[model samples]
Target chain A: MGLDNVTVKPHEKLATALAPELTAVNTLIRERMASKHAPRIPEVTAHLVEAGGKRLRPMLTLAAAKACGYDGPYHIHLAATVEFIHTATLLHDDVVDESAKRRGRPTANLLWDNKSSVLVGDYLFARSFQLMTECNSMQVMHILSGASATIAEGEVLQLTAAQDLATDEAIYLQVVRGKTAALFSAATKVGGVIAGADPKIVQALHDYGDALGVSFQIVDDLLDYEGTGETGKNVGDDFRERKLTLPVIKAVAKADDAERAFWVKTIEKGKQDDGDLEHAIALLKKHDALTETRVEALDWAEKAKAALTSLPDTDIRQMLSEIADYVVARLR
Target chain B: MGLDNVTVKPHEKLATALAPELTAVNTLIRERMASKHAPRIPEVTAHLVEAGGKRLRPMLTLAAAKACGYDGPYHIHLAATVEFIHTATLLHDDVVDESAKRRGRPTANLLWDNKSSVLVGDYLFARSFQLMTECNSMQVMHILSGASATIAEGEVLQLTAAQDLATDEAIYLQVVRGKTAALFSAATKVGGVIAGADPKIVQALHDYGDALGVSFQIVDDLLDYEGTGETGKNVGDDFRERKLTLPVIKAVAKADDAERAFWVKTIEKGKQDDGDLEHAIALLKKHDALTETRVEALDWAEKAKAALTSLPDTDIRQMLSEIADYVVARLR
Candidate 1:
């Protein structure tokens, strides 16, 4: 009945292992988020930064750095940089998605306005670039900046791809990578780069983060159809929003004549009515879309773990391997 | 009249002097604004980039570099970076301002949507950072990134300061610097740094840009109140929008009890009746606020010209000096 009997999540375990560096990252984030002239910047940033998410992306940076046997203050800066980028994207994403709730609270956009969200988000992105520059590594600057471009490009792609019925698996992958994986991979890759790890090891870390991000996103999308209210998202939220995620894309790919018209009405034209969620789920299940998506998620999770085999057999590596498993374990 | 009899604008002179480099910058801008996966990126960006604005900020970068005898190719990169950052900010600014028109054309926010504007602006920012990194100068990176943060901070400050009666000359200056002068100064300062100019010369270049930017913005604010038709902005647009530009701030500062109530009702409370613009202008003239604002703008322009005395007296420098004069010349 004690803590020993409970199953601690891999992220929690990783957080525990890297608590000291994580604290430094948080401290740096607080310091950097403050604006001497603009109190609104800090106020809006604090709403998102102090929101109690897992800080998983920054932890990936810390974990990657520690796994590569690096000891440096700059890793904390890089970790904070990753978190800032993630938080900034979250702020903008809420505006772009017109989301009202994030992490179970009113979004910054809702609390303030879209203007605050946009400007404060720009502040954070600029702050993130400032953080990365303090690392003084050209390679790091290139990777992080390149990742920023990819992230923005991906977001623009998602905006265009959102309701289109013709969006395929390749576009879905690109959008997912843009919205989620670009930062994830950049987060992990910059950690290794700052550590001066071997190029192969750096690539491996990147691959790990990329696969883990794709798997994590796919699982989250799948949960939109399959979950019973555990993931902070209601079932069929994506369907209600007329989003074309992987499962829906697969379902659409296999749709017959009658099914195509139904999807075109609901997804393409966004003309949903009562029981559309149920019918969408029925079609997804009928085409085995959810099952196939889950299988793909599992494969990506495996690939994440496989990528980690290139690293040294340290405790951090073991924790990372387990985190990959934990990512897909949500589907169970 | 013969071409020689015409009063060629100083910016046109600078453009004629730096045509090849401007061409290179234009070429580079077109190349980098492209996104491999998202055609929307180019479509949205081209709408703004090709919209035939003056391209003043990037020209400052090119002018500064060429004035310093920087024969290298990277100034084109730096100039393009400045333009990209400027364009990015404009896109986001239109969204924040909810502007329908920019440069006498429909803004990207209106042409596409706020979502496209926000995301495409971000892409350009990222692309700007990437372009700066290609210069391989850490000093350039630091200066540019720091300016980016300042620009964002200034914008957030402006947001919180808008419509507030307490916003004074100091806050107005800070906001002006943030919204306009930060990037201008950065564009010029980085050109000097990249040219390996002496620290004194670099400092002077920064001051020149800073003062020029401050003056340029004050004139713009003044134009909103005074322009008949030449400036593209309708007179009293700022007052209509309830924007606390320099004139309003100065006028508010000198307000008597009745005038104070007028400002409180119109600017702060956003309750305006017919003839408010006429009354507002009367208050500005009665209190000499517009005159004072124009004087300060002239003073800043003088300071901008004075700062350039430290640089090598090249033809580009002479054009830059005239450019400073031309910035305020519109007031006459």
Candidate 2:
């Protein structure tokens, strides 16, 4: 399914089964975003939260909880908490990347300043912690907190690993898992734990989330290379930033002596230009790295579907599995 | 008492009471700092944690818990949590301030890069949340979360208010409370709450911490002027940075036509040089703003001591109270 088709199906299903809960999550986000003490906090936070994110993290929390047979009100709070954490990271990520644009809009760092981005990000993180405290489940807190640590660690790892030609599959997997998949896994796992699911069910949900997140991120990285003109970002943004994504890492490993020298000069030494992106893409093709990356993503998608075996058969679970398929199907 | 005398007394007391707890906190910090998945995390975090500084926030958590008559081991974990939070903020703060030096050492920003500082700071914050989750106290989580929000808010407020002379006492107090006292109060309050102290004792401890923190910060600002020969930092560091601190705020409020113009030219317009610092100092003295700031610090010190009435007569309580006096006494 395309973006429009996938989005429409979720909207219809969510509106019917999870309407009230979704409303509660939305209200919680707005209310918590309003800081009585610090007015500027909401202003900076609103820029991102109100900025047209898909609310994927929070949606995962809700979907996981519902799929696991949770009927309690706490899921909404957790969903909102997850969103707050995601938004906080976004604000900080823009500053770390020093990127001027996000979601095709001016970044917080550009609109206001880096100072606002940093502080408001901190405020949102605090708010997320406060929200989790209200759930009153140490297990929930533990899962979310662990996810957060992994996410931050992943980001730092990515930072240090950027532009290093010697980056490998093991390190790349860890980075993607940390940077993109940790929260996804945590959001789903927390939902199961909060719903009082069995240990087996919780573990399955965690694996499902982890694999789905990995697949999702791999697809995203692939899109940066294979995306057509209609895609929002350019094909070589990661390359422009000198990032050593899967394609470049694989290509570097397979390069001949002459190609290896070119890779070192263009990537490691940051001597790339627009023409270099074309050459890099050709190199990826010559080495069949793109095909391998897609195969890896498909494998993760299959793993994600397999991980759902412990859950009871339900429309939500089926849709989640389909969603996993939808994430990687775009590559084909 | 002089700095040497005060340092000796507190160092001995802090060592004796907090040695075991401090050791545990340090061990926990080291353990938590490692991200098995992200190799870059340790590289960025160790640049700051191993840079050397007194672990005061963690000690405060341990001290507060001890003073509240608790004999539990969980406080050590909580202490580590607060320290992680504090260190995380410091990392980000250096980036926000564009600072080159902290405690006579090169900042992470200067050593590694701003990217490392921002990302590693984020990692530490996530680690903090993880540590707090281990404590499993809703009230403790609530207090720390609130403090985190306030700290971030204060930072943003400071950013927005910097170089603007119109900032008032109320706004300034809010900023100071957020930037400094919020963490202090939360750290102390969480300690008491975790110890299962009475509500009254918790409130007393919280108030004591807030006032003491305010006094401590004021003394720090004063030392920017008073420590011309003793302290290594240059005099008028805040003035040069155009930070509208208490002394500068008061002086600006009391300025005549010529004085106001000079301030506008130097601070507001960023036209300062070597002679400007001397003139700014002379103006501060001319209006007795230093004395005024000193008196305010003493008032807070008195309030901090008075807040201890709810605590029983114990050596720790007395030392905490005296520590308040000793902070302000540095001005004399």
Q: Which candidate has the top score in lDDT?
A: 1
Misplaced by over 4 Å in model 2 are A1-17, A330-332, B1-8, B229-232
Residue pairs in collision within model 2: none
Tell me the deviation in Å of residue A61 in model 2: 0.8
Q: A-chain TM-score per prediction?
A: 0.96, 0.94
DockQ of each: 0.87, 0.80
Task: Report candidate 2's interface RMSD in Å.
Answer: 1.2
Candidate 1 to truth, TM: 0.97
**TM-score for all models, in order of appearance:** 0.97, 0.95
Worst 10 residues of 2 chain B by lDDT: B1-10
Residue B114's lDDT within candidate 1 is 97
Please write out the lDDT profile of model 2 over residues B1-332, one tens digit for every residue.
Answer: 33334554563577576788888888888998887766667776777777666676777778889998899889988988888888899889988988887767788789888888888888888888888877778888888888998899888888877888898777788888989999888888988999999999999989988998898888888888766544445567788788888888989999999999998998789898768888888988999999999888988989988998889888888777667767776665
Candidate 1, residues A1-332: lDDT per residue as tens digits? 11121266888999999999999888999999999999998899999899888999999999999999999889999999999989989899889988888877899999999999999999999999999999999999999999999999999998899889999999999999998999989989998999999999999999999999999999999988998665676777678778889999999999999999999999989999999889989999999999999999989988998999999999999989888888877775
DockQ agreement of candidate 1 with the native complex = 0.87
